[model samples]
Target: MSSTDTGARRGRPPQTPEQAEEVRARIVGATARVFTRVGSRGLSVAQIIEEAGLARPTFYRYFANAVEPLHAVLTASNAGLVGGITSALTGTDEPVELGIALIDAYLDWARGHGPMLRPLFAELHDPASPVSAYREAAFDDIRAAVRGTFTELGRPVPSPLDLDAALHVCEYVVYRISAEAGPGAQPDPETVAAARLTMIRVLLTTLGTRADVEYALEVPGLFPPPGDD
Candidate 1:
């Protein structure tokens, strides 16, 4: 029997969740390269299939279209951004240390993903594009994580400097530092932490204690406690 027919005749053999997830991951990774090359407007299913080395018809088994898999790629990429920096945050008692770790992580992730993300952003921000939803969702996740950290820290819920705004400022710092510092610039831990703390202090003064309180409260969420979620 043909592979497709044998599979079909078995009344749909079960795939372990792990197995299914691996296939999905392969599809997502391949899509990143395709999207990076084509931009959102130019992206196509055939292109992703060609890049992925999969049969064209089989692409439908994993994704409805190019956009669906693109969302997954962006989501995984964003999660990695947060995960990359959390380990370096330890052994520092000051809140500024945590902020520095966060900023440092941002720069590291951006520098690595710039090529993939730069084109993705260009396609996403185009006025006529549907991919903006993915971008907005990613931003919302970042803001919520930041806000959740603040809320847990016993800080006020609303401030001129909430997680949403802090994210923008922090992202700009990361982008600028990466831009001007050059690829070889190795960030100084103490200095970065201190600079971040200063920025945090200014942000709090302008926006009020609510923001700071929230940061302290939500820090655990940002960097979860040992062995616990």
Candidate 2:
């Protein structure tokens, strides 16, 4: 078996939940940087160690190879976005408004984390070796949230064709917009902003929801705001 699969097969047990969480977080954060720097296929555990400031053995203590840590990073990114969507949905009675806010939140996250998102994009497009199952789960979660939002709005949950179509639209919109604005030969920020706004408007229209553009102006914080900032 490859070393990448060994950690799952045999590895030291966690002494405590906190320790496990810290190790997991470190692996993920490191993987994000490594993947951003080297792309998915080119990623190296040594690179992750350098980025994370952890020892070589410490890397193996958490993950078998770059792939596992990459998975952790993708999974964590999805979980964070899904959790934000859940919070936004539950915190408000108006699902329509929340839906708009969710789109903004997603775009904002992509803009801020384009480097991390790029490697997942590579994994998502990998044909011979599909290594993005974790990222796929994240997409599924987003779709589920979208479906639920439609139901909440008293609209029929989209037919499979429509749902698939809508998701593709969103995926493309987000990827292209972020790609243009991401580091290296960047476009004008105003142009990127215009494109993002156009995509958001198009997505909401296709999803059969009406919301104000001002909703985009108010990006929701990941945690509680201090005194309603």
Candidate 3:
């Protein structure tokens, strides 16, 4: 038998509740890695089992199919990202500062979760996938967070800034730019970070005041220095 088969045969004793939860977490994490690498259309249960280093029986005990674990990943990831964005925007009064803080929080989350986010973004449009619903909920959370920012700053949202439309645009821009410059794109992290910041500035121009746009441009760390780029 292959080593994998051998490992499967030597499975551990029955797991306690905490141990089972840990196993489930491992399976979900492995599912995210496999899904990120191959996408949902290409994902295979066998691949997840291999990546997770778990016996087939063990996997089946926790999940009925690959989609289940994927749903778990999406739910957890979206919650964490929304929490980070909300925390980042808290206490920021200026529109420009809010925009900068929002984008910075977004990029930081993206950088931290690039592997999972890439495929999550790619598969977000699949209607049959659980991630589709999760994506919609995430957008709603983002919209509320953005509107709250304006409310907190005592500024009325401009006519041009439809929170829903702006949220969609932000999602599209971030996903597109990351997909284009990610991994094999050969751009360094700083270069990608700068590009993301520039895109946020453009987004701010559409959703924010002229003064906000100008202030964002003047922010020192928003983008790389002229000589660096």
List TM-score per model, in order: 0.60, 0.70, 0.80
Worst ten-residue run, lDDT, model 2? 2-11
Better of 1 and 2 by TM-score: 2
Q: Give the whole-model CA lDDT for all candidates, comma-separated.
A: 0.59, 0.64, 0.74
Off by over 4 Å in 3: 1-13, 158-161, 182-187, 217-229
The residue-level lDDT of candidate 3 at 28 comes to 93
Rank candidates by TM-score, best first. Answer: 3, 2, 1
Error of 2 at 74 (Å): 1.0
Backbone clashes in model 3 = 0
lDDT of 1 by residue, 58-148 (tens): 6777789988888787677767765564443443434545555656666567657755645644555556665566556666655555556
Tens digits of per-residue lDDT for model 3 on 89-169? Answer: 894677776776777777777767766667777777889767789988987788788777777778775443466555666
Give stretches of model 2 more than 4 Å off: 1-24, 91-96, 128-131, 182-188, 209-229
Please give the distance, in angstroms, between residue 126's alpha carbon in candidate 3 and its true position after superposition.
3.1
Instruction: Tell me model 2's lDDT, rounded to 2 decimals.
Output: 0.64
Cα RMSDs, all models: 9.8, 9.3, 4.2
Q: Model 2: per-residue lDDT, tens digit, 179-203?
A: 6655433446776566555655555
